[model samples]
Target: MKIAFVGKGGSGKTTLSSLFIRHLAASRVPVMAVDADINQHLGVALGLDEAEAAALPAMGAHLPLIKNYLRGDNPRIASAETMIKTTPPGEGSRLLHVTGDNPVYDACARPVLLEGETVRLMATGPFTESDLGVACYHSKVGAVELCLNHLVDGREEYVVVDMTAGSDSFASGMFTRFDMTFLVAEPTRKGVAVYRQYKEYARDFGVPLRVVGNKVQNPDDLAFLRAEVGEDLLVAVGHSDWVRAMEKGRTTRFASLEAPNREALTLLHAAADASYEQRDWERYTRQMVHFHLKNAESWANAKTGADLAAQVDPAFVLAEGAAAPQPA
Candidate 1:
């Protein structure tokens, strides 16, 4: 299953995402975590020391190799340079499995020790000095989009993404890529405002979004969240001294976490597990193709000097155990 954590900046999405990934890893579940946020703080949140986190390779730094590898021998793609981030995998393209051995994972994914278990993580990387004026942060996120585009994860396995905050993800079809998106909102007006925006935009696209209220200190905060989000409210996580200590560089064990916060994590995990059973590969493929065609018509065709729509394999369907499409 593919899950995303998103919300207003500083709404604790990254922290919640890290906690969820750790929870899954500690349970011995096969999982991969991708920090697709521009802030690039997931490694630190997942218990990596500053130096260790800095040493991890950035996926954005290897776009060419990733694009080339995923393109495989697909005749329609022409060359790796012609493939945009929105490029949908089709005939002869490489497909990825969660927890499977692949060159992409070998190069970009790193292991982070959480308790006695290990979690694989990848980051979209931070903007370098060279990118000061030339690049947008979304360009860096393209690598993550491509990875999710080709990935075929199983129900038992998981890929959790820490998405860029707010409605910035709606700038691209990337918002539609997840099986479930947990929108972490504090009990503030600005917090629920972002939720309204996401709900409005995602309504037509069938994005399964749930609201996870953060920093609820009293009955008022909880009531505010329930009134604003209604049935979309999944769970509310209270303040955590354990998280605060971890943030301050004072080490603490997960077992020492407050029971309520711990239960909230379990609820989030259970919600995500329920989504895994509802995976719809055909709809997933259609979404990929829809975005690919939209990009092709809008800019990719002129940019690549090819009719990029031809890249779509009409007969191709993405499903567990489905065969990769053959080149026409």
Candidate 2:
């Protein structure tokens, strides 16, 4: 299963994303935690020492290699200019299995041993001061999406992503990428507003948006979220002194997190791992290409436009008996 953590800024999405990675790893599940947020704090949230986290490689740094590998041996994709997001994979195209034994992981991923469980970590390189006007962060996000496109997750394996906060996800097709999008809303008006905006947008993509209330200090707080979000609320997390202590530098370990947090996480995991509606690959690819073309026309030149269009896989089919399409 693949999951993404998203919410308004400062809503604790990173903390929850990091905790989810720890939970999956500690359970002996094969997991990859992606820091797709521009802030790039998922590393520190995962409890990595500053130096160790700094040493991790950024996926955006290897865009050339990623494009090369993903293009693979396909005769149709003759040049990077023709490689689109949905480009079909042929022999030599790297595919990531849950076991973490693939060229993608080997080439771009860094190993982080948390507790006794081994988890792989990858980041979208932080936006630097030099990139102010010349670059779009979506390029890195595109790299993440391309990598995810090649992965095939099974029962024991999982992918967790810490997405950029708020409606910024809509800038690309990223809102459609995850099997589950865990919205970590705090019990506040601003948080609820973000929830409404995200939920409205995700409804168009048929994405499963589960609301997980964070920093619930009392019944009133929980009640506010419940009233605002209603049935979409999956779980509510209470304020935790343990997490506060960790934030204050009183401890470096997360093994002894408060029990309520653990319980909330367990419930969230159960929901994530549960069977949900499958997405239509054909429609998804087409919509992705449409967005690519739109983006290309607006900014990218002709060659980049062709490259984005070329990534579509012509053989994609919508699975029968799949969940009904969500109304756009």
Worst-scoring 10-residue span by lDDT in model 2:
319-328
Question: lDDT tens digits, residues 124-188, model 1?
Answer: 99989999999999888999989888888777788999999999998788998888999999999
lDDT of 1 at 183: 99
Instruction: Show pairs that collide, candidate 1.
Output: none
TM-scores for all candidates: the values are 0.96, 0.88
Best by TM-score: 1
Clashes of each: 0, 5
lDDT of 2 at 61: 78
lDDT of 2 by residue, 1-328 (tens): 7799999999999988988888888778888899999888888777777787777788887877777766665565667555544444433445555563545566678878876788888998788777789998887777887776656565567889999999998887767767789999999999999999999988866788899999899999989999999999999998788778756656545669888888888988888877344545565556655665576566554645454444444564323222221111
Error of 2 at 29 (Å): 0.8
